[model samples]
Target: MFKNLNQKNNDSIRVEKDSIGKKEIAADSYYGINTIRAQENFNISRQNIHPELVKAISMIKKAAALSNFELGLLDEIKKNAILEACDEMIDSNLAEKLELDAFQGGAGTSTNMMVNEVIANRALEIMGMQKGDYDIIHPNDDVNKGQSTNDVYPTALRIAVLKLLGPLTKSIAKLQEVLQVKEEEFSSIIKLGRTQLQDAVPITLGQEFSAYAEAVNRDRWRLYKITDRLKKINLGGTAIGTGLNTSHSYIFKIAKHLRNFTSLSLSHSENMIDITQNMDIFVEVSGLLKAASVNLNKIASDLRLLASGPTGGIGEIKLPAVQAGSSIMPGKVNPVICEMINQLSIEIICSDQAITMAARDGQLELNAFSPIIAQKLLNMLEMMKKAIDKFNNKCVKDIEVNSDKCKQILDNSLAIITSLVPYIGYEQASDLAKEAVNQDKKLIDFIKEKDIISNSKLDKILKLENMTSPGNNLSE
Candidate 1:
């Protein structure tokens, strides 16, 4: 149904020419071109391979090279070449010359091929040898020795994500810091609290800000908890979970070397069967991302509402103006970063859905879609990390509360009746609240007219501190 998307017509595209096996090879549509075609051919969704997969690829190569170097599978000279090539890929210089898409069906076989080609070509350049000189340093026998895409790709993804957990924790910590500051700043400001988008009672603005802080803190802790689980990899499992052709010593040896190289707390799974079958860790990470998204989305939405207007709406708060608000309207500033963060939340939420769907697709022995699941989950993590960084550094840290606006709304609020409970009693206060709302009169005016409390008493209770702290025990 979607093959038409890959159709090539009369239009010409520039091509590079090279030699392969004594024959001229045209770089027209063969090298990594199948991936690009598949991308177009399978327009089932706009979803592509996650960017985090690149980090995963780099980690795997590093792990493999370190293992090989320690176990004498390769000499220092070859290992150095491999390391240099892998580093180049990490720096993303090879991407300009290569035209591969990040997605493929053979459980990242295409990605593996792309990696092999990049390393081989770069190694050739390093050795002063021509590109594709397999005999000098073959892509398969040398670079991919004793490894399969199945083990290597997933292991790389795990390591990459585990590495990212550190920065993500820091981002969450930064956001928590911003939230803490807001909590202190707004501690004495009371406003009507909403339960289901309807007014319920009064709550301190500080309380709401503290809630956001707790949420980010929880997510940071959860991500840290899962980091150790991701450290357990399937590198020694080989191709079909049998460890075929691999000696018993090489299994643990490779994992140990990889651990030292990455400087990460790494371990090997006890059961290859369970490792290949259960993707619970992947699902767990995805679920955590979803939870984080919920908190962030709610926070973003609330910020937008709180910072709604300076003239018309409930403009109790003000967000930093990072960009011009309108193309036509002059002197306007917009809340674009908040909007972007909200959209990122939605995308991360959708990635969780993809993870769930992919996890459920696993069968008896192996999950064919583990690669995609790993890719998507890691992508969500990175995206969330980036969003949190931007929101905290750019938006949250610079937010300002409109003091005069908040005071104006609070002074005119009938919602202040709850604070009068100790003085006027609940029933009388409730009655006065309803009367004030009906007449659209300020609570101060209502209190003064009804003589429920003396003017001096009302003034004392109406103080911000008194409203925020109901246990002051001052008599009316």
Candidate 2:
């Protein structure tokens, strides 16, 4: 039932009453009393619920309507109204009107209620009735039939996460492809490879880029595998896992309708109680995201160090100059894209920690912190996707290897002494390395000065190719 507010010059107000009390709602608003209460109670984060989540929830409602119609539980008129309302919500992006804070109490009941009230009012409009006419089409009885926030919230969260993973996977794969291209481009440029911040051996620039490509490829694969975990959803398990107040036929058939509606490979969880009680699946996906973050962080750090300076530091590679690096230094350029990715990675890592704690803090039947987990996880995914794209287009693809610098550094490195040990024995090679370091001379130059071996043998032993890989013995 709805009551028009009779206050003078307040024609734009309507009265909606729940168990708590009556509240004034906007006449044009699709949401109702529960949503208003949530908006007023939890103004913690001014940010509203994410649009993807709202869309996912709308899809669930549409699927439920279709399922109820097929089961002969709901009349065709109401089903058509609900379906049309859902279509309007999705097509016109009506979720922008949902103003409840993403972080809230009641285990996402407020979020569920916000969606329900919007759909209920929109359905009433489609039926040519005024909004908040629960007597004709109740939000709980008609729109949200056979569902609960416990089931619907987590299920919608899974759908939203799966939707986001598609773009994230593509971004990561694109980054991997770019790194592979760089590997081929830098294949022949040889450089010094360092361990523990000290030169250890000779390596081609291509080999370093290949390692980065391989790491990203692994992350892409893990992202693909994590979708399987999300596919199993706990829909139709109203309240708890007992499937209380829902028909067995509805319980078994809802997932089929949801899969068809969402075009996602969704399946009903075999054990609803387990799925509801444990949010480890979300934690598992978050862990994989963390793994991807770790890989990106390491690659970005390596690029920053490699592109440290043109006159000092490694200076073996140059990153694309996107902007002026400093306000004070006139000619400075920084690896801002790499820095951005590094900072984003750190944020993703911290988000994962939050999700982990939220998952662990589950009480008895439900996890009240799902709102925060969903918010943090979605934010991380979107941020990481953009960061990867920026890093790939602006940095990785534009990386320029300094071949001259590589050769110069390699010439000065005493790490080449490793190649001489196979032929000269360990004690002699150690003495030569010490002398080369003490005299501040190249290993090749020191060897030439001492006449340790014949010129031809020394030349054969000290080949750059010999130092980088394994093959024939240097003594041979």
Best by TM-score: 2
Provide the TM-score for each candidate, comma-separated.
Answer: 0.83, 0.96
Tens digit of lDDT per residue, candidate 2, span 202-312? 899999999999999999999998898899988888888768888878977788888987899998889998777788988998999999999999999999999888787
lDDT of 1: 0.71
- lDDT agreement of model 2 with the native: 0.87
Q: On residues 1-476, what C-alpha lDDT tens digit does candidate 1 reach at each position?
A: 11121225525342322232133222222232334444444445455555456545655675677667777887787788888877766665443344344444666666665666557556666777755566777676677776777677777778777777788889998899889999998887777666676555566778889999999999888988888788877776777666775666777777776676677877877776566656778888889988988989999999888888767777878898888889899878777888988898889888888888887887886777776686677677788889898999889988887777766666665666666887768998888888888988877777789886777877777655665454653653
Best by lDDT: 2
Query: Candidates' lDDT values, in order?
Result: 0.71, 0.87
Name every residue pair that clashes in candidate 1: none
